[model samples]
Target: MTGTDAKDDLHQYLREAREALLWKLDGLSEYDLRRPLTPTGTNLLGLIKHVASVTAGYFGAVFDRPFPEPMPWIESGRDENDDMWATAEESREQIIGLYHRAWAHADETIEALPLDATGRVPWWPAERGGMTLHRILCHMLSEIARHAGHADIVRELIDGSAGRRPDNTNIPPLNEQWWLDYHDRLDRTARATRA
Candidate 1:
């Protein structure tokens, strides 16, 4: 890809990943969004919240800039799994809206800065010094993609809904014959193990 095309591609991937993450929350109750998928309390809403915080950190505060809106959890010393689970006081709209706003802020930073532009990550390990906007954008996209995969699985478990975005050509179809074949193999395996 050319320079402009590569930037657009990366930005498009970031947007799609963000959308997929939010899509997992669609048609779900507030209770469902807050429900823990794993023992660590990873939930849909919490993931969005966490991403917002990290995005603000990398694209805003890390660049010696401040985000227009404040994220209280970072100051409240409750960041842990707080992003993965929503509290009673936290509404679905609020968290999702914050994520949308975060995307706007992150996009601004991406637009204004060049890939080679550098910033400090004070929280990172001492051995690793600061990083560039390019690196941070790549890191954010990586993080979003990882979390989006987790969201896909959790969404599937919740409603048996699974497919990729756009054309959804990545999804495979399984008919009743396939199910029967798989079950027959499982039954044979069970008989052999018992024998």
Candidate 2:
């Protein structure tokens, strides 16, 4: 299609992933949002923080736009994985606000540059340092979507809520008992095939 149409499509998908990730925070307490539900310490708020850093870097520094805020967690000489989780002092509102701001900044970069406009990713290896706005969009879209899936599982473990989004679950209309039975069937089948 036209250039505008292609850019809009990519932006739309990126927005969808962002919204899905944020929706997981709804109705959750600060404690619940920060609780490490998985063995790897995958918390809801942390995912938001991480994605914000990611988008800000990809769409900002990579494009030479530079998100207007300092991200100490991602700076050189910081503890490894600092961006992967929020500190105890960091409130949900703070992290979420930064995420929203990052979105706005990234949007500015996306709007100003054509999809084929080139830039260098300083953090990337030499062979892959050169990039285009289109490539960054696709990469961020995939990254956000992958983390959104993680948020889905972590959210389900917390409260039994599971869906693509609030308005569109896209899952079968199965009752709790039906789901339990479905899992039971799978369990039995796996057991039967065990070596």
Candidate 3:
């Protein structure tokens, strides 16, 4: 109903997405967390790392408040895809820590600015680069939530564990056989449509 209410709502959703993205790494070995599950090399830890980098940018540099640390992987002429995966030397705690710090920094920015506060996205064209805090919040919520969904699928592929969150799986409470049968039915239907 009010500006503060809207901001709070957006913040809540963004926080949930961030948590869900991080939860995918729970109970995974280092190999499993970093192993590429998709053709493009999507992995749980990498997803967390990518989101951390993204959040730091949108909520950090975009708002004239750069993340306090230098991210060499994202700076200079580094490979654009370099931030999407973790190096063997990068511990899971490090990536997750970055994400958490990004969250705190981003939160500070959001709380410090009004919804109408303005900033420019350095990467965007000048004509469309101007943005309000509310706009950035919406953009970030969409971006983070999309990656959280990717984490969900990657986690499923890794261990057959499916859920939006640990507590609320958001899937049917059906038995394993039911799920298998459901998968078979979908497979049959998809194959039939190929004719």
lDDT of 2 by residue, 62-171 (tens): 98999999999999999988998989899998999999999999999999999999999999998999999999999999999999999999999999998899999878
Number of the top-ranking candidate, with lDDT as the measure: 2
Q: Is candidate 1 or candidate 3 better by TM-score?
A: 3
**Clashing residue pairs, backbone N/CA/C < 3 A, model 1:** 46-83
lDDT of 1 at 55: 84
What's the C-alpha lDDT at position 71 in model 1? 73
**Model 3 stretches astray by more than 4 angstroms:** none
Would you estimate the TM-scores of all the predictions? 0.86, 0.97, 0.98
Q: Per-residue lDDT tens digits of candidate 3, residues 1-195? A: 999999999999999989888888999999999999899999888888889998999998888999997788887799878889999999999999999999999999999998999999998999999999999999999998899889899989989987888899998899999999999999999999995
Q: Give model 1's TM-score versus the native structure.
A: 0.86
TM-score, model 2 to reference = 0.97
Better-scoring candidate (TM-score), 1 or 2: 2
lDDT of each: 0.81, 0.95, 0.91
Model 1 lDDT per residue over 30-120, tens place:
7777778787777778888888888888888778777888776777566565556667998888888889888999999888887778888
What are the RMSD figures for all models against the true structure?
3.1, 0.9, 0.8
